[model samples]
Target: MAFWRSTSLFSSSTPSTTTINDNTINQETIERLCDRLQLATRIEDRRDALRDLKGYSKKCKLEVGTKSMILLADILQGDRTDLDLIQLALETLSNIMTYEVDNNDEQPNLPQDITIQFTELFIKNKEHVHAALDLIEETDFNIRRTSIKFLTILLTNCTKTLQDIILESGPMGVSKLVDLLQDEREVIRNDALLLLQILTRSNANIQKIVAFENGFERLFEILISEGGSDGGVIVEDCLSVLLNLLKNNPSNQSYFRESSFIRRLVDCFALNSIGEKHWLKQKETNINLFLQVIRILVSPTNSNQNIVACQRSISQCGKKKIES
Candidate 1:
């Protein structure tokens, strides 16, 4: 949050441009971390370097983080077989990506050379970046979890530069994240759902990914999944994502219908509607989210059968809620 740049960096005509000046405090920390990381011959040494690298990333802030990140990227680009090292590197990347989006320390009137080149290197070269992207598929839960967490943070907080870089990276980046819904871990699946929600909320060139052949099916699986207990994270996140995907997107709406998501929804509601009227009381928030999804799916042009099915679900919900 401290400012080291001079007053002249702020030109009246250039309000949008900001730059990261080379400061001794930030630069020194970055240099030390880089040296430790490069000279890491022992497992403990690498771990310490990764640990300090993460700390320096934060301490250096925007521009300093950029320089530290360039070195960080170089370390990761090497063939890193050590799982802990990989996790640490991925986490550091996540922190760096996050720093790119923080505006609190931004000096808007300055030149933006360091930050610009910093971002350009990561985006322009796809091969160097794939090492982090490949970690999403690791069977190791911790690595996969870190990768997923990193990705969701990137998509949610980063500006268009990162988004464009991701989308432009083609199937390796965004597509890989989308494919995690089928992951065995419920936590990972929900994390993927969170990512989809961000993409939906942002509407950043996500039409193709949403309309993928199995995308609807995967989301539908989450909708009816009984994986989690009454917290209803699966149901809550799926509805948010489905609503976002279907809103103002007629093609996806049609796809939703074609994919039998409505039928599955009705079945899920009915499945949850049995025995006592008190059953629905515990899942009030979930039912509301489900109902909201139904609201989004219903259109004036829908066929009568679809309407009847929807109404049946709504009526079933209502009946289930009434005290017997």
Candidate 2:
């Protein structure tokens, strides 16, 4: 028996019932499967079907290639779909991309084609941004988290469209991205930070958005308030964003200098006597960032008192060069 026949069909116990084959999964069957996936009461069932479809893609089962890609793209384009399903679709697509990379396969790069289609869909569909925002607020933390990851991937791959979406979404979208900094999941937080970092780099207008929104303050708060957490991933991410923002807007160096952000970063170095685990590793990052911020502040062009304060803070923190 073929792989699709072995895995795609479900045998019914009733003698009158029949197993459905891959060939039978025509356009209508694809539509019905998509409908069931969208409306399924049980997450497990949806997940199982998602897994099967992803597996089918991996095995180069092109029988349902166009249909599966279209269905998955539809899910990606849906108005109020379950975030878990969205994430599953995204991950499945990502896995397909990875398989394509590893196997040097070119035929079933349907996901990439779908990505282009979804880029257009997201651009033309007014509901796209709202759906993404809703997914960010999903009750399931993992779903919420993965959606951000997918969004970042989408944004990275489809920069022009994502930038347009961000511009249209405006301060509200910026605020939503800021709120994710406090998310319990570090990956989501990091991705949000990264998006902000990317957006700030895209245009000087975004600098005004960041400054007007007190974005600098929020970044500092995350670094100072949460740096001591489990692995300091939050602190590292926050610091990276801060560094990028500062690099982009040299004027904002004053904000970091005045807001006690420098001191807090220095404190990370001072307090991180712990051995080299995740948190300590992150501590080293904070220290390096602290030094870089100091370097920026103390440049002859920026001879503010804040520069002196930063030097003093680093001195007090003790000299510890970040290992390359």
Candidate 3:
């Protein structure tokens, strides 16, 4: 989420800014904010502290590192009625959890030690992960969306640990994520695709659960809805998730074949034009991912019948894309 602020140079009655916006925030300020977050009796004070912390986190990664994760998680797990507070905490946690280490000279990237510490602290307690999953059940799209972003960061930093927790949360955890695929908001839907793709990359259990949750079917439905190859990066993102599911897992591969998704897969290859200019990088990438899915299904490891069936599906395809 992009942060936007409006400033009035002539106004004198504005609220005092706790976090210095220009320079890297100091550890003293972070500790003060965490103290407020931990001890604040009223929801308004907690929100004020979290708002300042969220602002500080965007610029000073190490100062804010892992200091308030426990406090934030407490708010998430304990507070149900304050949607604004939950959203602020999630956003602040996301900023603190950001793992990308930029080499920019203006602001030094977080050291390796801090990054590992952040990941370990969050995963050490299973409730933190559970609290994150619970926030998604909230009806507010902003909270749900921020929760997804926080989970994405967590999953990226600690893939193995987070994957285990998510799987242990039962089918409900992964199911809620799959439901995001059908979100009426495109941004939410796209973020869910990326999250599921990362979540299912190496975990066969998650891949199976997602596949059972109609992962393949919904992905194909989204593909058609986005205009197949005529769509943008979303088309490639959808194929990437499909490829992960079908890649090495025999069960998912068999599911793809049995579900008659092979017909749908081949239909995506029918582009408006095959000429060089017509094939934008994104379309070519989508088509390339499509071939990968097909290859996985028809690999020698799969049954000979499955290979023949997939081959037949492709051979029978015409120029026109299949209607969903």
Candidate topping TM-score: 3
lDDT of 3 at 148: 91
lDDT of 2 by residue, 172-243 (tens): 776667677777766666778877766666465556567557777777666656743333666666666666
List TM-scores for all candidates, in order: 0.69, 0.61, 0.84
Whole-model lDDT, candidate 1? 0.63
**Local error of candidate 2 at 233, Å?**
4.8
RMSD (Cα, Å) for all candidates, in order, is 7.1, 9.4, 8.1
Candidates in descending lDDT order? 3, 1, 2
Span of 10 residues, lowest total lDDT, candidate 2:
1-10
Q: For model 3, state the Cα shift of residue 45 in Å.
A: 1.4
For model 1, residues 68-98, the per-residue Cα lDDT tens digits are: 5656666566746677877777777765555
The TM-score of predicted model 3 comes to 0.84
Report the C-alpha lDDT of model 3 over 56-76, residue by residue, as the tens digit: 775666556546777877888
